[model samples]
Target: MTELVPTPNNCVLPRIRADFATFNDAIDYAAKSEKGMNFHDMRGTLTRVYPYSEMRADAVQMAYRLVDAGIGKADRVALIAETGPDFAALFCACTLAGAWPVPLPLPTTFGGKDSYIDQLSVQLQSADPKVLIYPPEIAEMAAAAAERQGCEGVDWDTFAQRPAPEVELPKADPEDICYLQYSSGSTRFPQGVAVTHAALLHNLYGHAASMDIGNNDRVVSWLPWYHDMGLVGCFLSLIANQVSADYLKTEHFARRPLAWLDLISRNEGTTLSYSPTFGYDICARRISSQSNVEERFDLSRWRTAGNGADMIRPDVMQNFVNAFSAAGFKASAFTPSYGLAEATLAVTVMPPGEGISVELVEEERLSGTRRDLSRPARYRAIVNCGKPLPDMDVEIRGENGEVKSHHQIGKVWCRGPSVMHSYFRNQEATDECLVPSEDGKGAWLDTGDMGYVDAKGYLFIVGRAKDMIIINGKNHWPQDIEWAVEQLPGFNHGDIAAFAVETENGEEAPAVLVHCRVSDPDERVKLRDEIRDKVRAITGMNCVVELVPPRTLPRTSSGKLSRAKAKKLYLSGEIEPFRLAA
Candidate 1:
């Protein structure tokens, strides 16, 4: 047996070692080692019939064509297309050419076309890409965006027309930048995190090792390509490990949640899939609407159902599992992982094969005092994000740069091969995130999140240290309070921002301002009361709930809520104040 060595163009397949004197022996070994099946454009009605081999070949050809089109090492290529074969091919092509791909989301995720264009403009200016490749339908929009940013736009058809070149691929160094992943920028402007080829490979290897992914595994996922989880977790990991995979359109899944489950059941997908909070919501809604929903899809084959990209709620996971349990879905399949674009994708994944693990502590203890993983009864349920990946190290440090002992809450700092090189050309911003070691020796990336590691080495995320609300000497995660309030009727799904506000005398109290889409004034008042009551019941904390018009809640360019800006508007009196019933 010989090992397969990866050239710059192709991801090296995992290999075994043997005494081989010639390169031919390694090539022969790679050929016989059983390459995994790969698929692109596994969406709409085409997934049932698309050949896996054809997709891989097409992607390789696309890579060569992109190289011939002057996209070579270090060149930046912008992708503004939907999730399908085209996007996957472009991504692979960029990777093969050693060019960095900047994937921007389609306009559909936001409320309107103008908003999308505005966000895209900002990204285009910051990335300063050489070419913009997009689908034919959106060619005009891409052209307009490129023209506005002083760049060229190439339609997919034209981009694909370039002949595949026969040039020898360069050897890629592990430290060379691979892709530029744009952050959601919920609290600030969007910034691009420059992840290196080494980082990407490290994460893929880490994920494969942790999940026990093999060539025989088949992945079914509907996550958007623009998202880090979708690209690195589902697409790249499948390619690097040579596993078969099927991709559904993110919008299609949103419109028809059953399609996501159907793809899994039909393909018998054995490993790999992910979604955010809204995905669970959509699935639960569809399952509740139909009779015998459980019998419709057998999900017993699913190995890792990764829940990430948003705040993970124990209630949401439990509800989704309960809804699909009748269909042979296992509760253990729900893996509560934690990650961000800066880490390429995953920093920690819940240990596979184990059922959902959680710790319940007292709310008062969690709010009034430090984190106590030992005081199980004093805190509410906090799901474990599992241990760090094999190649990574995690530490919890306080504001003074001292490491906290186990069970003490503090900012999370991580150092590993998977960490991004830096934010693209933004030294100040990068410096803020990638902090120096306390001893001034090495570098560690600050996660901007507050959490602690348990005695057993399981990590539990409390919340964003910046987003924590301090009211009357007690701390509260705005997400917990926000989730409680959002459960009330009449509160729009994306129209709530909760934060702590300081009064004239400098006393801090929780302030929840919700954007009520409903028009009836009486109903809005009732909804506010219901929200307040729910928050009080859950946390024993009194909150000021204010109801405003729809779309009043501020959001980032990526559509995530901007709590900091919301608070600023409230203090400046730009946001209307709501009064409680006298």
Candidate 2:
């Protein structure tokens, strides 16, 4: 048997050019370097080494084939965002062929086959892609969705073998649309974010500059390619910046969460990796009681552990540090960031070495409510999401569209080259969020997220404005209820989802759906009571608590809790709760 050798982390090529004019140009330059992408299997074993040079040649072939097939400039081509060479090369090929590649999500564990088909069909209708390409493993479902949308669907492997007569590929201009990305919370009628080559490159520049991507830096990622962070930061940024990277399939990481660390341990060079807070929570729980964290892992060289895509939990971050401190993981390496799909990827990233800095703000301030003199003030920990990216303007706007003062939490508004041009084919939705700035310089995007910037210019996220549960003129964040229940014995993150629902009397009240694992009938009743009591203590009023089977709660494609969908399912009678013994 031959030995396995991963791609080198550094190359002798004189680094990136001044800057890439377009993503296609970035790909052309990266192909000249020796650095490339390394693929790992489920158990952290090296499986394939995909060199940039070879990827470029393959992409060019596919580009010619795309042109021959009548796929031309600005044509939309949908592709299942799988973590593999076929998808990678095909994505690059789309840019080379001057088509907007739409990166759609793979079927997640939360949604079944029919659910996944419905999701794909909705997105296909929105994107109106000329074709939908996917891996053969999911051919049946992919083809079904494509057929429903009246579009052609083919597996990437077979498409790769299609004849390619030499044909002139269309030129990709900097202002041309680079790709289409849908946000994670897209259960119905989701608008696609249309990003241009110029916007994509500018965001990449900001992301790279903020992180200070060093010469010795290598990235290890398990984030799904469908999300903005994974697609732009880890995948596209690496190419445009001419850096080497290693990847583990998101599904494999789900099965063995610690394999992400194991793969990182095998790489001795300094590394940058990212995930939402749940990723760290999973790994820490996986090795919490174990004593071999230091023995099995060498995380001494891990330079950056990025946390984003959700609200950063400091308690979870602290728990991770306690579990991995023995493994040489530093608390200073946690780089929490804040961004959205509408911004192309990153708006603010904490500088390296400035780990998690949390501020204790009154819960009422977070919800913009009057202090209740009857009860002691409750404080919520808001993590500092760091400063704005270069050329990215950050502002907090009140309900009247006026800019708020420091420590004032409101809608997070940003304007920059990286902000998406528009939502595909949705003029009303575009006009809803992208309002013109008072300065008349550029349009500012209302992020729909509630946050504030401090005196030092570090941003702090409160929560999503849409997820707030308002009852009787008082506001309550769903996380406040969910976190309170998670304090009980058998609860974990994502195990509880909280939202607002109307009572039989048409009065609004907080409703919580918890993933219960207790089997005994009496114990289930007792557990439900305990959860209700816990939530009531937090809300100062009784909440509707339902105990559902474990994993019944739905997750977004990026694995974040889908409170909106969970509420929808519960109301629609799809998620039946266990009946309590009377």
* TM-scores vs. true structure, each candidate: 0.74, 0.83
Candidate 1 wrongly placed segments (more than 4 Å): 1-44, 48-64, 163-165, 184-188, 364-379, 438-442, 465-576, 580-582
The lDDT leader among the candidates is 2
| TM-score, cand. 1 vs. native | 0.74
lDDT against the true structure, per candidate, is 0.70, 0.86
Q: Where in model 2 is the C-alpha error above 4 Å?
A: 468-582
- lDDT at 571, model 1: 69
How does residue 209 of candidate 2 score in lDDT? 88
The best candidate by TM-score is 2
lDDT of 2 by residue, 1-582 (tens): 787677777888777632788999899889988888999899988888998898899999999888878899999999999998988999999999998899998886644677678779988999999999999999999999999999999999889889899887777788999999985435355679999999999999889889888777899999888888889888999999888889999999989999999989988784799988878988998998888888999998887899987667798899999999999999999999998878999999999999999999997786555887999999988999999999999999998898999999888999998999999999998999999877787899998888999998999988754676645323356776787688889888899999987699644578999998888999998998888777665555788889998999999999999997898789879999999885
Task: Give candidate 2's error at residue 558 in angstroms.
Answer: 33
Alpha carbon lDDT at 183, candidate 2: 56
In angstroms, how far off is 410's CA in candidate 1? 1.0
